[model samples]
Target: MGLPGTIPPAQGPARPALAVVDVQPHLQQPATDRGPGRLHLSAEGASRAAGGSGGGEAVKVILLRDVPTLGRAGTLVEVKEGYARNYLLPRGLAREATAGAIRARDVMRQAEEQRRARVQREAEQLAQGLSALILEMRARAGAEGRLFGAVTAQQVADALRQRGFPVDKKQVELEHPIRVEGFHRVAVRLPTGRLVQVTVNVVGQR
Candidate 1:
């Protein structure tokens, strides 16, 4: 028997002693255990991580011809390794701008400049010719001046062709399709970066 509030001893091993369980050391390694430089990436691995092909680095190239949204001929441009390798290099549109390539580009620079000047002069002359020219188009329309069908760039181009001007429909830039009968100013973009406006006189057909 035990006094009040006193714990009685266990009768047998079926109820063993309440000893603290020993905790074994954790087997998992800490992040700090793997120090810096424990793993080094090769050149190929680094290149892949940097979005390059294989182990190849990006290169500087000289344009051999005009590239839309890019530099013109003889201009040095830096591009991705894959683009230089696959597109520009294979198409002969660009080359690695080494000392030799720079020399070659220098030799052709004068000719390219002359060609560009000639194109500019021709575009200016064409713009001047088109300035005074008015294209008349006849379309069926209602009494309120609303056209039965919209006037397209192709129709305007055809009118220009009939008037002895050689122009493609793509050269004409219209903000919207002409849907009314009236005189409207149309803008055309020339290859030499010149913008020319032509008067398109839309009249109702009799």
Candidate 2:
């Protein structure tokens, strides 16, 4: 009630951002658990992810990339129809995991697998050579053989590169910089998570 004359404002509950599940004509699938964070889903399994009638209108989708709680790339998972139609589909993060879509991706999946295997083989071969390596480095030292400056991973990596090995400083798993001169066994980590030990011989110079 206003003193003179005032129109009363209309009152209504605020709508939730993702409340309405606007189901479209989008027909979509089950996800297979590949190892830990991956999956290879079948057509039928993917469709099951999208509920038929009982699941409150869920939609199955194959993720193009990892979604926080949903699934990883290539994994088919169920989501709200609204989420699929509005967010995931438009953002290019996922696609409808239809039976045909699942079958169509088989060739691409195989090629990716082959590429991964080849990379693994290359990493393993390099790791073997690094394991048998004895790398020597010279640095200025005191009477007690303590280095004036610590030997770093960058220096080690540079030395390895000079010897014709493609090494990155990041791959040198040095727990700490070497302060004292001696034979220190350093681990060179590979892309496949394998650690190869390479002996680093630090000699004192004037």
Per-residue lDDT tens digits for candidate 2, residues 11-98, read: 8999768777755333232245344333233345334434444335777888888755566688878877865676567768788998
* Winner by TM-score: 2
Which candidate number maximizes lDDT? 2
Candidate 1 residue-wise lDDT, 80-113, digit = tens: 6765675567767778889998888887887878
Count of backbone collisions in candidate 2: 6
TM-score of each: 0.51, 0.59
Taking all chains together, the TM-score of candidate 1 against the true structure is 0.51
Stretches of candidate 2 off by over 4 Å are 1-49, 52-62, 66-71, 75-93, 96-104
Which lDDT values do the candidates have, in the order given? 0.75, 0.78
